[model samples]
Structure formats: C-alpha cells, structure tokens
Target: MTASPEQIEIALESKAWPFQEAQKLVERLKKFGNPKGYVLFETGYGPSGLPHIGTFGEVLRTTMVRHAFEFISDVPTRLIAFSDDMDGFRKVPGNLPNQDMLQQHLGLPLTQVPDPFGTHESFAHHNNDRLCKFLDSFGFDYEFKSATEAYKSGEMDVTLLCMLEHYDKIMRVILPTLGEERQKTYSPFLPICPRTGRVLQVPILERDLAAGTVTYRDEETGKLVEVPVTGGHCKAQWKADWAMRWVALGVDYEMAGKDLIESVKLSSAIARILGAQPPEGFNYELFLDENGQKISKSKGNGLSMEDWLRYGTPESLALYMFQSPRKAKKLYFDVIPKAVDDYLTSLAAFPEQEGKEKYGNPVWHIHSGTPPREELPVSFSLLLNLVSASNAHDKETLWGYISAYAPDIRAEDHPLLDKLVEYALVYYEDFVKPTKKYRAPTATEIAALEDLIRELEALPEDAAAGEFQTAVFSVGKAHHYENLRDWFRALYEILLGQQQGPRMGSFIALYGRDKTIDLIRKAIENPRV
Candidate 1:
C-alpha cells in the first residue's frame, strides 16, 4: 500500500498537496492494514455564494485519497460534506443579483438568503444546490449534512453543552485571537438576523418551541428583540466553533486552503484538550488569476467551473484538480485551451503499467486522475485552425493528423485521441467567440512576408535544420528586423492576424505545403484586425 520510490518521486516533483503528509498517511495505513475503525473525510460548504472551482478542487482531492485508502485496504470510508448554512453572512459576494436582498437576510440562517436566482428559497440554498450539482458532475459520492438539520436533531446539543461547559477555555482561545473587546462578550456562536444580514449576538433569548418564536436581544445596543427559530443552530462562530465541531463529529481527514492552516493548527490543540481525535489535515494553495492575484468568488477575478467547462470536459477539469494544490498558481482564461489540449495528449501517453505498479493496483488511476504531461502535440490554436481550414470534423481526420505529424503519438492510441478531440471541441465552443475578420496586410507587411516566403521556398530539399534557421533569419536581417523573432512576428501578423503563434516552420512542416499555404491565404483574407 505504501507508494513506491517512483510514486514518491512523482509526488514530490509534482508538489502534490499534502505531498509529504499523504505519503506518511499511506505508509501508516499500510502498517495498520485496515484497522477496525471508520475512515472519515469531511468538507464544508459556506453557502455564501456560487461555490468556486477551489471548493470542487478540495473535495475532489479528498475523494482521491479516500479512494486510494479503499483500494489499498479493506477499510470502509465515509466522505461527509457539511453545508454550513448555519453560518452568518459576512458579506455579499460579487455576481449576486441583489446586494440589498442579502443585507435584508443578514443575521439569519444562511438557509434563508432570498434566492437572487429565485429558483431556491434562499441564497444559501441556491449555492448549496449548485455545489451538489457540481459534486455530482465530478462523480463524488458523499453523505450530505446540513447544519440546520444537525442542530435541530440535537446532534450538536452535546457539543453545544461541551462548549458551554468550556466557555472560559473558549474565551481564552478566542479573545486573545480576536483583538477586539466587543468580541469578548460575543458568544463563540451567533445567529444571523434574517432581516439585516448582520450577526446577532444571540438569536434565542427564550425559546417557545410550540410557537416557533424565540425572544432575542441585540448585543451592541441592548435592544430587546424577537425572531422565529423554526429549526437549526442559529450560527456557529467560524474557525473556533468550526474546530470544535470537527473534533465533535469525528472528522478523520479534511483538506483545506493555505489561508486556514494556522487556524486548523490552533483548532487541533483545542481538539486535543476536548479529548477528541483531530482529523488528519491537508493544506493546499489557491488558484490565482493571470495577473497573479488569488482567484476568489468574493473577488470575481477568475474563471468558474462552469466557465472552464465551456472549453473543457469534466475529465479535463478533473485532471486540473489532480494537479498538486500545494503552490499558489494562476489559471489564465486565455491559456486554458492549450492546457486542456496538453492534458489530453498526456492522458493519451500515460504509462498504464507505471501507474499500476506504483500505486500497487490495476485501477485506471492515471486515466481517472492526474493532470496530463506538460508538452502538447501542437498549440491549440494551430490545431483548431488546421481542423477548421480542412473542414475535417471527423475523428479519423484528427487521428490522421496526429499520427502523421506527432510521431510521438500512434493511431493505435485512438481512445486517447478521441478524448483530445472531445476536449478540442469543448475548447472551440467556449473560447471561439465571433470577432472582426482579419484585415488585408499593408504593402510593406505583404512585401515582408513574400520575401520570407521566397527565402523559405528556396531552401535546398533536405536542408539541415541550421541552414533552414539561417535562411529565415536572413529575411529578418534584410528587412531591418532586429532578430528572427521580428520576422516571425510580422509573418504571423500578415498570415494569422496575430503578433505570434506556434513555431512557423514546424507548423508548416506538420500541416504540409498545400494545406499550410491555403490556410495562410485564408488567414490573409479573414484577417482578425
């Protein structure tokens, strides 16, 4: 069950999340060999807004480990995802239809956000439903729990009593960490006021279960208040309360983003004091934007899972999830097409025996998980242009091109090629928006391209690679272009209406003389000016 040296090396090289810790856990499990105890994994949904890609990424990786454990041993594993709808709304995330509506739902259970989408009763429910759909799309089978349901069932009553019993211990940990006096009197837990979207100090003053109303008070101004407490725990203070609940619920493993690493560390200490087994932890980094900013639902700065799917299949997205989440990495919207193509190519080339031997199983783990290799057969744009220009939409044409040009690939590998074609189709659909046609090149640009085309044509048949490179460079020098890069840029601009693209010579060689010339002519006619 322990990972082989090659597996450990790959994990380290890839910097997979909990890279070292996962190895350790695997080794531990191998030693224990399916202990007569439950293996549990936990994830949470804040119900703040549309759950972002990061949320899916966390759960998917957790599922990977859970499956790994199941495959390696006979232990039964439980993956539980809790929707923390009981948590109070902190702010209205961007892309929401109504900010005012969210404010009105403040201080209320998240299950009550007035659904801006109008399909669900509340914003919290809307997001929770979306998360469920997303999880289902990714093939995760999990036990779902709602905070509202857990609280009403008195599942947390003992935990709540425990918190009350250790109120001082909670204060000691919370107050020093909070840095605000107002927070001192605040119960570690508070309910959201449905009318204001503000955190109420305590939503329940005196409960009239039969009437479904509770007497309440405003913490800030000592104003008497009342609100309906139909069901559910009002709110659990995040971080501190979250830590307590994890221990109370017996979470065996949970993956989290880097931002919460310190909080989880502190929570683990608290869990120990409460005589609860702290869950094994995996800390991961966030995906960033093209400008190197963190992608966040609150920030609204990056692509959503839905956005990605426009150009990528669920499997491609899953491969993206398989990437190590240890380092903060940016996912540029423009770069995804090529990345998806590369992932498909890698999947095609995946070493099946290597995967089985390394993981100690015959499962299709590599195909089912992991990002494709970094190198791609060609740039996505180039492939799309070839396919479009040839009007060859069939899988055979696609496979033929791969077999002919990408010698590293084989036609016998049609299964992986089919995946690539599917991925390419999705990419074309998502990113190929209608734009103005390419414009005709000016006299000087046309003259420049013609001269370079002549020089390339005049190269001796079976010319050395170096000689071919020099012939192209000579055109740039004659045209007063500073370098070969300048010549290529001008050629691309004239031919493709872009400053640069895939390597021109390699592109031409792959597509053949007639097809390349025809495509270049087409590009000239439909210049994307």
Candidate 2:
C-alpha cells in the first residue's frame, strides 16, 4: 500500500521508544475511539513535597509521545499532569519551611494543610504552583489538574458512587493483598475525620448508596459519622482512587515508574469493576544514583531539576528524559556534561540523518521534530576546562579561547553558546572552583611532556583545531603513554598544572602554538618547586 507523507513521517517516528508508544496509541484508537472526541494522556504527581527531576521526566516523556501522536493521527489530544494533593501528608520534608508547624498537620489532606513557607494556600498548592512554573519555563503545553479541586467540585461523584456500589467487590480484590492485621478493619474509603480534619482509614460501618453517603466508625472516638461519598467528603485508597480517576477522567494512556507495577495492575482490575476500561500504560524503571540505589528525597542524593538547569540546558535535560526509560540509568551531577555532549552530537549530525535514524535522533525528540540547526562552536565540557585554564570570567573571555581555536568563529554566530557560558560560569563556581589543583609533572612524565612540546612546535600556526588535535594524538602514541588520558594529564600537570583540562589540541590552538612550546621549555628548564 502506498503511504501518505504524514504516514511515512510517523512510521519513521514509530521506530523510537516514546514515539513507538504513540504509534501504538494510534493503533488502539482505531480499535476503540474515545466518545469524548479526544484522547487523554495522564501523568500523576504526589505533592508531599517539592517536585523533583523524576517529576520533570514523566511530563516530558508523555509530551514526546503526544508530539509523536500528532505526526500520525488527526485525533485531538490532551495531557493531564494531575497532582494527588488530596492524599494525606504523612511525613515532614526536611527541605520545606517551618518544620515545627508541619507536625501538627500530619495525616491531614495535603491541600488542607497550611503551607509552612507562607507562599501558597497549602503545601500542595505551593508545589503545584511550582510544577506549573517549572514547566512553563520550559514552554510545556499541558493541562494541570488538582485532585483536591477535582474531588471538592464533585467531578468524581459518579465514580465515587460506583466505588460505593461495588465496595464489597473492591474489598475482595484488595484484602488478600494485605497483611492480616491490615485486613482486619481496612475499607476502600478513607474519610476525612469530621472532628479532627484528618483523612482516616477506619471501619466502614455502613453505606447509604441511595443517599450517596458512607458511615465510617472513627478509630479515635468510636463515633460513626455519615458523609457524602463525593465532594471531598471521601477519598479512596490509592489503588482504588487510581481506578476511579481513570473512569472519571477517561484517561486513555498514562506512564508510571516501574515501582508502580503492582499498583498499575491493581488499578486496572478495579477500573474494570468500576465500569471503565483502564488506561493503557507503560511501567518504566526508575532513575538510580551512582551506587545504583534508587534516587530518594530523604537521601538527598539525586540531581534536582533546578540543579540540572543551573549547570545544563533544558534541551540536554529533555534529551536525558528521552533516553531508554525502561532501563534503569544513573542520573547524577556527573551525567550532565555527557548528556550535553550527546545532545550536541545529534544536532551536528541531524542534517544528514534520514529515515528512522533521523527520527531516532534525541535532538529530534527533544525539539519535537524541529531541532536547533545551529551547532555550538565547541563542546560544553571543552569550554568548561578552557574557562578554567584561561581564567575566563565572562562570555568575551571565553570567546577568546573559542575564537583562537576556531579562528573563523564569530561572537555573533552562536547564541546557544552565550546561554551556555552563563551556566558554565555558575557550574564552575559551584562544582569546580573549590577543587582547583596544580601539580608539577613527575621526573618520569617530563620526558614525554617535552616530546609533546616539540610536536606542538612543529605544527603550523595556521593549523586547524582538528589538525592540531591529530598532532597531539600522534605525540601521545609516539611517547607510548598508556593512552590519551596519560598524555593529557602530562600536559595539564606540567603546563597548565592541573590534574585535568580541556582537549590539548583545542587548548593549544587557542593558547597559541608558540606560547605552548615556550611554557613547556620553561617548565623543563626550571621545574616548579
């Protein structure tokens, strides 16, 4: 069958991970269309505290799928970044304001709890506002929904009644999965204690389905109170609420971390019993730290979205989110520079790439099929080290090294580099400046260093960065250094007097071939004491 140009584009995109997910979504839509005239994709958040990198991840990945969906189908789509602010606040985050004030509100709904920081109405509101702010900064297009608002407005009332109607059936599905003690008095409904304003999971004394109310005996006072099953009077257990949300919102697709596999399965079953088919979903593995442990807020070990943006760009972070999500990967401060490099590499090659390879480029996904065409004059890591070597205090000073290395480069040519210079300066101050080191080369290392200096002297002053780079590589091979690392170390320690620096070729090109040779000779003749 002959395919349309749009179909060909989508088919190319279909080869990628998230786009592949979107293509699957299109296929499913053909099987069963949403009667609502649009496909809904949801990614949920728990606003117990501040949003993290993982929060950015889910929304970004879902948006990629949405972008891919647009390439394939004409169906309208919406992404719901729903926040579960209705959930109880069980723990006080060490990072938030007024820790002493939070303890009094523990076990109440997060939206009902006061914001210790005094910024928003509550902790949940503060976090939700922050989530919107961050996503807006990245220019994300999404619909933000608050669970508290959704429930308080009686939007989930029908689903709430459905849960009440099938309370016995829902319990049968949930009880066996629990420990014996938890099974004794557990009910699917968690009512906000009328006296104390805390969401309580107490024994369900009875349900008046016709009246749309549930009577639950409070554990604290042993008094049974009746409240409407909806309108924020009642909240379901997480598994039950997940199903209820699906049925209420008509979510067609959602993705969650691999840790929620059981939760997703249980929610799917409950959703079926509640009279709506569960949304199709992908359970991806969670991000890990350097030690392969899960990145945790309490541990304070994972890189924050703020941290990533302070030192990295939104595009690099977007590319990081676009990588193999089902496979667990380490996300840390050290990973940022490489992610930046990989993003640049894809941009440089994007013009020539075709077919699936073109669609598969992370840049293509990062930019939603329109990646930046202009490439940076030098890689970010190279620029960072160059900044260190030359004491570049601003863009002009940094451009000095950049212009020297690539003489044709103009300050007006690269706008991305200008933004990057700001990030690199802040990054250097925070991560690099404290550990700055300078050491003379060992007597054994000096001979190889001198040989490299002679090679640099022979290279023409007009040599290109790549040509000078080749000369540096040849010198390393000739001297039988273990590898380039050893040779580069010699250059850094003996000349720049640091354990590591930028690529010697580019550094030499910018630092001047004559000055480089002169410095090496001076070091050899009068070794640093």
Write model 2 residue lDDT over 1-529, tens digit each, in one string.
Answer: 2236775575555478876787778778888766989889999999997888998899999888888777767788899999999999999987776888999899999998998879889889998999999999998899999999999998999899999999999999999899999998798888988898898877788899999998977666777789888899888889999999999999999998999999999999999999887887887889998788997664556888898988898899998888888899999887887888878888899999877788788887788788878766677877777666656678888777667767777767777877777777777777776776656667766777677777777779867777778888887888777777878777777665567677777767766788677777777887554
Q: Which stretches of candidate 1 lie over 4 Å from their true place?
A: 1-19, 26-36, 191-199, 202-234, 352-381, 385-490, 503-506, 509-512, 518-529
Residue 526 deviation, candidate 2, in Å?
6.2
Q: Which candidate wins on TM-score? A: 2
Q: Across residues 1-529, which tens digit of lDDT does each residue of candidate 1 receive? A: 4445665565445433334444555665566443437777899777777888888887887877776555444556798988888776667787788778777666566776688888987777788889998888777889888887787676776665555455557667656666466664555556555556566665344544444444577766677666543234355567656776786677778888898888887677667666675678788888888889888887777878887776665665666666656778777567676556545555545554353333422123433333344445555566655554444656677667666676677645544455656556555444442321345666766666666557656764444445555766676688787666766766655555445465655556555544555555555555546
lDDT of 1: 0.64
Candidate 2: where are CA atoms >4 Å away?
1-14, 298-300, 436-439, 482-485, 492-502, 518-529
TM-score of 2: 0.93
Which candidate number would show the highest lDDT if scored against the true structure?
2
Record all residue pairs in model 2 with backbone atoms less than 3 Å apart, i.e. clashing. none
